[model samples]
Target: MMILSWRRRRGGHRTSKPAFVEDNPGMDLAIPTHFLCPISLDLMKDPVTLSTGITYDRESIEKWIEAGNEICPVTNQVLENFDQIPNHAIRRMIQDWCVENCARGMERIPTPRIPVAPRDVLEICSKIMTATQRGDHKKCMELVEKIKRWGRESERNKKCIIENGSGCVLSALFESFSSISIQEHEYLLGETLSLLIWMFPLGSEGQSKLGTAPSLRCMAWFLKERNISSCQNVILVLKELFSSDEKHVNAFAEIEGVEEDLVKIVKEQTCPKSTKASLMVIFHLISSSTSSEKTISIFLELGLVSLVLEILAGPERSMSEKALRILDSICNWEQGIKKASDNALTMPVLVKKILRVSNLATDFSVSAILKLCKSQEGGDHQQVEALQLGGFHKLLVLLQVGCGEKTKEKVTELLKLLNQQRGRLDCFDSSMDFKYLKRPSL
Candidate 1:
């Protein structure tokens, strides 16, 4: 009754290898072939039967189902049901076989835990919702803690919870906090939002429920909390909500103190992770053309330009890239250009990042400089500053070494602007040495 494992050959089939007993000096033990799973070609630790009347290891079959395959892997037939019924007979036989081969390296396979069913999840969610509706705050929080425990148990359980409408349930939990003072249930709200973040891709309905004015305000309030995890959860949920819908983005923009709060997150949050999230939220906010003016004005008024320049001066590539992207977005407007040029470090940092970080960073840096240099107000002064900041050398090097096509075009244009102002600046010795400054062949 010993179970043998099969090994695949270079050809396309499997061959079984029997375990040999070292204590018996070359005695080969034949294992029952039926106890082996076709998918793994190994001894089935927990055998389960599919709708096709084919049995495979539970782990292998569960993975196949999780991969979105509905057909039986062996029978190639459409599966009527995905439920895996454990084959106790085969499992017991395998256990007995392992015991008989104890003298060898064979070890007994432990019993597998029962999988969580959809009904069980639904029952738990119903209890939580019931408690919530009854204003049983203590009971509701306790149930939520249990749900979080279940979700953290395994990916399978989390997927089951989401599939069973747990996202909507959690969204309702967030909404439930609206009428009640957040201070009373701040910890509960944080836990609920944290769970919702884990169950991402929350449908439009769920997002809409959570995106209500009250919910948005509650999330904003979380940003001002002393708890770092709560703040992180609020930003992450907002990131998803705003990223999915423009309406949510606009709605978020309208929230009082959101801009200042986000900037505060960027400047003061002790967590680097939270700061990065804040930068992304700002990137999304300013990237939208509709909110460009207001977003840019708020960022500049809050000294965002100085903060970004400081980030660029640091060693983190991702942070620098995101900062440059935000700068590029903000600089699309006239006011943004003026603000960037007004900052002393803006031009110098833009030039320093030209060929330094990445292609994306280089493109954004060039675009920001190009925007600033093309403006009519103080455009000439900015061009002169660019040359003095060694921007002329950087652009020349970029063109000579080559860069993205669009970036090359921008550099050519900026170089032309500098060439026109060459006489006003002493940084460029002679225009002849700048002969290569001419537009490159498209």
Candidate 2:
């Protein structure tokens, strides 16, 4: 499937389609960044060619060689024999990607997957911190080293990867804040939060899991030590994670137990713009974690519904699609629509915005809307009625007429769930919901 990407163009009222060799949507034959150097799989660094039926440059190829790395991008075989470059077959592939923005464009398309964990800051640190308390520094060190190794290796990938170990380390560090007295909480939290921030894009997997580690034990430590002040720094890092880009989100996906602290942080402070971004990440990966509902409700109580809605209502496709992803997750199959009624969230109005997006939106935006609608407990007549009152039926009509059988199936299930009031007991079905669709923009 083609993932639509926006590229700035010159002398255009809007973007006209660039000539493509295939059906790849992300395949912008004009963009250079999308292409990988055939040899390193990094940027086509120091691109050059040799004459003897082979090719390579000195500077770029030399570094990977010195670093004890031998895999060649094209062959996937170890380049122990780097005697001559590969053959022209390999060189031709390099030239193609470089000459075009992305060669066949198959290399960079993102395939979505099911995530199994939350990226909680405290939960991660608590894992190792628990080991530290028990004098199992050996275990703690081992866990930390595993995290470090995972991080380094992950970052090396051409595709984004989650950096789980950093959160594990950070979660462990926050555990320290609870060990010390209240006065030390701020310092400790700061030190710990800084370590997470410092780790930044820890080797590029961009996310990891921190599920059910020893992190929860720290909350008791916090209460015992009365170290709530340090919670402020934890909020800051959470805030930073949100405002930071995709890399940060991947790192955060690894955390296991950070929701309550976010509650504590939000309760103590006004909404930081960073919180908005951080919450976006949080909402996406919150899933069925123990703390997911509480965090979702709290963000709602903070009246972030309006803030989140603004993203939903806006038209920057990247942010808009992201807003939908978060919306779909929180609604828990569209549960967020009703969250306003039972929880402190902005369910009703959020539902209205979502309906508007579905009926009037185009392309990926439509998919986002349907996903949220799909997330709703379709078995719940009230949600269907609520969305229908907001003109959701018409939106579904638009989707059926404007989109394909795939989208129609999602819309059909949404309609069915509303009609029968039953959801698929297992996981949400996205096959029915398509992410990319052509639109005349109803």
Candidate 3:
């Protein structure tokens, strides 16, 4: 089947024939069968012959090869090599045909340059390595931009770049630059970060290398930068690195201002994806039992408790669940409990989230509330607030509908607290609905 290939030209026009036809609809000239690219079914501009003895547009064949297809699309035979030889004869014929039909709105295809090859990508990486070794910031910047441009040119170029160890080279460069003050190399570092983001999924190995403490410190600095894209990239890179392996979390959390920057991202609600990534990273950093106390202290100091409560009250289910999980972790600390209970939205958000999102979210919500009520000094006030927020009914319904033993235990404990306090507190609204509230024989 034929597919359209899109490319950007010098003047911002697309190279796709369909786009051309859309712009010049009056041109209804029929193209010769031999003049058309077999893959795209458009007149071949840069015809190239493959090892399988078949001809296809250079861009299409290169895309196919870069996509890891080794068999000829037309011959159904295994390809011996990926090298493509330009068919000058057919290209000339097509160009001449376009000229003859120029009055009919036919446009001639420009001559094609040699597509980026694996060797070409390796050479660029070599230059970048040399420039880094020599501390040639200007040369490194130029090479990085060149590579970035090639990445933007075609998927084939991107594949070639990655396959030729560009990821490793870039990781090394980023790490080396991270040792110095970000001010010394702001633009270069920012560009490198942007490039790294574009070449995501740096595989496990690349991510592992970048998951180091130095790299994490660099990431934290990037987060503090005024450049929004740089901050986003740092979040994304940290997400990928931490998600790949959790062993890096402890070191990452220890970085100064890491938690602060992450909290800011969630608090400000910059972008949904980054906000979620920030949440997950926060969860990872504090989820560890060994680091929970210290990490929670750091987060609590940054007003994370209030931010988490606000997020739980939000409309995004995924972000809410993530925020709730962080809340559960935060409540493990005494200070976290104090900060959480002080937040006006804590009880209401937690009660509303019970049975509201998913099983996991329900677990987090119930656990967070349990921790708060049990640990907080003014337990009576929280218990009263829980009842006022219909938390008692929700707990009753939770027991009736069933849940994990741990969650049920928490519900039973919290329900007992609420019921025990319900008698003493006259603030409970008797008119509140209890149709779904089924009292378990506690």
Candidate 4:
């Protein structure tokens, strides 16, 4: 059972021939069977010979590796190693075959360049660092562009770059951003940040180094730049750098205007991915119990409460969930409770999002409202507003719907609080049974 494949011509037409058409009535062209990859059944662009004596395209084999296969596809034998040796001989033959069949509408395949080796990547990065240190801006920029191209060219090159101390090199480059002139800083730092984002998932040590005072200053500069890409990259890198590191989180919060800039990004940036990245960073920083009162005040003054309310009102479930979680974190603090309680929209949004987004979102929203209602700052107006916004009905629904234990507890507490004030509130429906408001046992 053989398959026939069509090769597209330069004039936007395709020509097909049987796999083994030695003598056809109308056509005589035959494509060599071995010229096609076994996996894709297509002509190989960059043919690579595996250990099991099978030749496949580089991309196909890499995808196989990425799929967690540890053996050759054709032979089903354990591969000695995953090294993909370029089959230049077979590649040349394929190119020659394409050239010969060009008149028959076959497109000629160009020769693939040898992939950059780890040693070469290491040396180029070393030269880049030396050039940067020597103030050879032109040389440094050129090498930086080359590395960027290499990183973007193939995952193989990126892996090679990362394996050969690219993290340390990037950390050094990020640190140098503070010393560069303002005119050149944007271009250089922009290029460096783009590279960093590409080669992310940095090690803990590398992350700590990159989160230094100088690198953070450079990131601050990125936020102020008119280039939106740099701003997005800054948030992404910070998100990775600050994950699970309390020291880095504290350091990041201490960056002058960092919180304000993050709030601005959430409000003004149109890219949802970047906005989420900014939100995650903000969540990590403000969620920390170690976050100072001054830090909380800074966020409040920068309108974090209003921004979160606006996001919760939107239709994105993920963003709303994240916003709710951040609200829950901040609301634990006295300052956060006061700020969220003061905002007219916070209580309403909290009540609306419960059971509307997801279980996690429901839990966080319930927790935020509970904190606000328990606070001494939550006066009659806020409490009445919650009830008017159908808070009591939502609590009853949440109890019946079987939410998490903690959520049930919070709902019960909120229901009890509202029940106490029910006589004075017109929105409360007293006709409904209140038996379901009993708190769940621990």
TM-score of 2: 0.38
TM-score of 3: 0.77
Q: Can you write out model 2's per-residue Cα lDDT over 1-442, one digit (the tens) per residue? A: 2233423333211223444433555544333333334454343322443332224433455566668866664445665565433334444554555345433432322222222133442354566667656645446555555444434443332122233454545554455434544343444444444345445543222222111122223332332343444343344444443444333333333443444444343333344443444444455445434334555665566554455555555555445544555555555533355552343233343444433444333333334444444443432544454444543443454564555566566566556545443242233232444334333443
Better of 2 and 4 by TM-score: 4
Give the distance in Å from residue 256's predicted Cα in candidate 1 to where it truly belongs.
4.3
lDDT of 1 by residue, 113-226 (tens): 566689988998898889878877888888889888887767878888888988888888788876677889888888898899877778988898888887888998887664
> Which stretches in model 4 have alpha-carbon errors above 4 Å?
1-29, 51-54, 63-82, 99-105, 129-136, 177-185, 379-381, 430-442
Instruction: Give TM-scores for every candidate, taking all chains together and pairing residue i with residue i.
Output: 0.78, 0.38, 0.77, 0.83
RMSD of each: 5.6, 16.6, 6.1, 5.3
- Pairing residues by index, what is the TM-score of model 4? 0.83
Tens-digit lDDT string for candidate 3 (94-212): 88877786554456778776668888988988999898888788999999999888888777678778778888788878877776656788788778877786566787667766876
Report how far residue 117 has shifted in candidate 4, in Å: 3.4
In model 1, which regions exceed 4 Å deviation? 1-35, 43-46, 65-78, 88-111, 117-133, 253-257, 268-272, 287-298, 333-335, 396-409, 426-442
Model 4: per-residue lDDT, tens digit, 287-335? 7766788888888888888888888888888898888888998898888
Winner by lDDT: 1
Rank list by TM-score: 4, 1, 3, 2
Off by over 4 Å in 2: 1-174, 198-273, 281-286, 289-300, 315-318, 333-336, 339-406, 413-442
Q: What local distance difference test score does each model get?
A: 0.80, 0.43, 0.78, 0.78
Off by over 4 Å in 3: 1-28, 58-71, 92-115, 200-214, 289-294, 358-360, 376-384, 392-442
